[model samples]
Target: MIGFIELIRASGFAADVRQVKLVRHKGDDLDMDQLRNEGWFETYQCFQSKPVFDGCTHIVSVIGEDATASRFVGIYEVQGSTTASPALLPEHCPYTQWGTESRVFYTLKKCPGFEDLEDRVVIDWGKGALAWHQWLTDRTIMEIRPRGRVLAPFRDFLRVHLSFEDLGNLATQPTAHKDWVAALSAVGGIYLIVDSMTGAQYVGSATGSGGIWQRWCDYAKTGHGGNLRLHELCREDIARARHFRFSILETFSRSLARDEAIRIESFFKQKLGTRVFGLNAN
Candidate 1:
């Protein structure tokens, strides 16, 4: 239960405590899924309908991911701000059109001395939605997960759901998500990979000694997992792999035979029409 300000000071942020504001940003008016999946959160936070940060010299930005927990984004030094206009929005702004004219567009630059702490720190934002912005001096640190937070804890096979980014993170930083990796490695299973961009799906199985964990790690590294269709899809454009979402279709006990796992995988491929209508070619 260390104080968040103490961590900031320890990290070499020499600014006065009074000049810092803790801002927990959530997307209520925007498409949060798209923001998270497509990287629109920063622009969304940069321009807000209200001047919430008017009096702050520096703001510690956090993205609200849970009911009272927020993941640290970064410390931003406020350069200046202006009344939002249609022309003020960047071309990549998620919205098709802007109808609100009362918004404020902030000009912020990433503050130095806090780069190592970004995305690795989480703080307990004291209960309540009304106080999204508060003086930094009033808050305390909650938990600092190494390599940042994983998608979620491993509850059961049915609860397994991961985006491409999540799989990559788990594959690269196994210790941070050891529970999930351990669970995945303990049993072979049938898994599903869907392309969110085209809604194309591929059903596959993992029957090797390393189980589903090893299979997914291959996908994370090569973006194909040695599948013919997946390799072709990624060969032309590797970035297309970012649109993939992974989930478990069925789990099999370690004693299950390799043919049995493949049989279950084939059933799902047929049920989902993945062979003729989706990404699966075999």
Candidate 2:
């Protein structure tokens, strides 16, 4: 089996394996979702509790779970470090209590030449995931996915479940997965949006011309989907939408009337107590 360090060396990013540390970032599903989807994982990693990467000249970063192969994120050149500030944390950061921990913020520069492998390359880091930070000599190359972890093909609508980040990804890259768009577009549906932060739910339905896809795209873009209560919440802090998770309550054929869709949505709202106990206003 070819080593991960060999591939990195061949790519011409780092000439010496001794100077590099292989780091795998794995956390709870919520943290992992934000890490992968929120676009701040690299910056977030800078706030370590200690100067763990102090002596390393460079670092190879991957994200995955313990006992599982990880996906390549990037290679970063270690520039230097400083004490972390409470204000430096992202607003929606999962690690809100980092202030309690004595953290060192390391300055890292993205190494060039390996941009093509981001999210496409996978590696095996042995079974010691608890030893997340390791010397480059200890890692192994597992697989290289040319498609770069494309979203799985659309399955059943009843089985449809998506995080807020998931919806944003699908909306932002509509052309990336035609089958998913096609599947969502094929039906008008009653859907549920749950604020994972507060357990509040918003029940809604889509019978628009473009079906569920169009309606959800609006929510992905605006975070409120034109609802009064959600608008109020997002107005206070837009990042709060990151706490939302979406799923289908029921699906309707395109032939369903708008009134019938609304009726179905009301049925779910009443059943789920969204109006009285959740985020729904009506």
Best by TM-score: 1
- Measured with C-alpha atoms, the lDDT of residue 26 in candidate 2 is 82
Q: Tens-digit lDDT track for model 1 on 13-112?
A: 8877687788877767653434666776656666777888788888888877657878777888888888877787678664735425778888888878
Where is model 1 more than 4 Å wrong at Cα? Answer: 26-39, 89-102, 129-131, 147-159
TM-score of each candidate structure, all chains considered together: 0.82, 0.68
lDDT of each: 0.79, 0.80
Number of the top-ranking candidate, with lDDT as the measure: 2
Q: Model 1: which residue pairs collide?
A: none
State the lDDT at 237 in candidate 1: 90
Q: After superposing candidate 2 on the true structure, give the runs of residues whose Cα lies further than 4 Å from its correct spot.
A: 1-3, 36-40, 65-67, 81-96, 138-165, 172-175, 178-190, 195-200, 205-215, 221-244, 248-272
lDDT (Cα, 0-100) at 175 in candidate 2: 74
